[model samples]
Target: MYDIRKLVQEIDKEHYLNELEAKSKKSKKDIQQKMDKINKQIEVLKTRKKKFINMLADEKIKHDEYLEMVEDNNNELAQLVEKKNEMLSMLESEQVIDNIDKLKQELLQFLNFNELTPAILHHPINRIDVKEGGTRVINYRFAAPTFE
Candidate 1:
């Protein structure tokens, strides 16, 4: 008889790896898009600041109002810069990659076990549905495998 535990573990690991790859790609892309948006906003604020300076030099606006505008723009620019730096730091860190690698290694170790313990099953499986004629459907905790 086939070892059901081994079969389930194999299936779950394959599904998990695939899901992780897709999710990581999406997350990186999202972060990159946000960074781009922040950069654009920074550029816009810088342009506005320059225009304010030109208006002040030409004496088109009162000095006090120009100073107030410059202060507001500086505050907003500082916040955006801080946010961009944080995002860049996150991109530079290997934490996400390391965590995924660690999980993969742990799952690989499971291959050494001959039988699935309750802990192993519970970690990956959400529920099991039994159908007529002894067929069973497993719902994984993460996501179901896409056969296609």
Candidate 2:
């Protein structure tokens, strides 16, 4: 059996840290972009809602129609708000980004003992596939590095 821990031990800490930080930054930017888009959509809906209210007040739209439009707008707004909150919560989470040193240490310890503990294995190895001709394919939990 291949000692999977050796792979972790061989990683260059600085390179791994750089890759992790880059990934984190990209993820944060993507989430922020989505949130900004949602905010813009919400603003547009609010404007439409305001217009509907004005129309109703001026006796241009019937009461039932106004109520239905308002209800629809409220439901849509609620959904967008919920999605925005979820994105915000994700952006606020720093657990993965803050634990690089700890993770490195743990990986080193696991490698030193050459033990395949469930926690250690599951933390880094996503899966292993056995192929024909005794070939085994390994997949990592994080983005795999490309060797030059």
Candidate 3:
């Protein structure tokens, strides 16, 4: 459990982050495909219910049979909708890897300075110009960090 190799992909944080993003994208695609399939199934059930109604109107099927078939169709639709809800929940809960570059920069800052302070914020700046509309202009020092 304490093994770093087990926790990350090949001991490279950038590579690990990229791999996570790729896996997340693939999982989203798979869930989207499954939801598409469920949507198709729901459409078919709806079409079947319409046909059931048409059969009753045409006197080809009895009222009782039409009701039974419609009930069964609705039940199947409900089940599929439940499945779709589950997939949606999974999609919402799925971990997405975004802003990897920003993450890497933060991680590097953490590695360089374990604790954050006002001094750290002011270290690589010439001056900060505050503007009127919730905007600020930042001036950088000649020795400002380039993150190279």
Candidate 4:
């Protein structure tokens, strides 16, 4: 069975890429606010794991109880790490690359270089093609740009 939620989320990838660009232009405080929220979640996970370890260190706790605490904390930490990695990879994938390429093309259009011919800009000296007597001759008399 096809899951509709997964399909919707796939469509949202483009929206998320745009959000990344907007965030880049946003205020530093706004950016840090969202980043701090993520850091808080990570800190909470670490603190919970620390408590699990501390609880297990008590001499009164039974061996099975200690093992259970350690196992639960380890599982939670593993899940968090996996989720973070998945998000990171999604942000780094080919869809984002294509989105960035499109954005660059748009920006280059604004730069007025999008329509320039490569042949005119590529050579230091402009050489007019000459074909005489079925032979080609190189002309180096063309004036090129100079910097003082």
On lDDT, the candidate that comes out on top is 2
After superposition, the stretches of candidate 4 with alpha carbons farther than 4 Å from their true spots are 1-39, 94-148
lDDT score for residue 61 of model 2 = 100
Clashes of each: 0, 0, 0, 0
lDDT by residue (4-104, candidate 1, tens digit) is: 44444654576666765676667678778989999999999999999999999999999999999999999999999999998888776524434655544
Compared with the true structure, what per-residue lDDT tens digits does model 3 show for residues 1-148?
1221232223245655666677778888999999999999999999999999899999999999998999999999999999999999988866445444454454345336667687776655568799999797766542211121
Candidate 1 weakest ten by summed lDDT: 139-148
Q: Across residues 3-111, which tens digit of lDDT does each residue of candidate 4 receive? A: 2233334434686546654544453345445545656677787887677667767665777887787787678767766666665554444243335545444333433
What is the C-alpha local distance difference test score of candidate 3?
A: 0.70
Computed on alpha carbons, the lDDT of every model, listed in order, comes to: 0.72, 0.77, 0.70, 0.51
Off by over 4 Å in 3: 1-12, 99-148
Expressed as tens digits, the lDDT of each residue in 1-148 for candidate 2 is 2444544644546676677678778878999999999999999999999999999999999999999999999999999999999999988873456665665666666566566687865766778899999898878655333433
The TM-scores of all predictions, comma-separated, are 0.59, 0.62, 0.62, 0.39
The residue-level lDDT of candidate 1 at 86 comes to: 89
Instruction: Give the Å shift of residue 97 in candidate 4.
Output: 8.6
Between prediction 2 and prediction 4, which has the larger TM-score? 2
Clashing pairs in 3: none
**Model 4 clashing residue pairs (backbone):** none
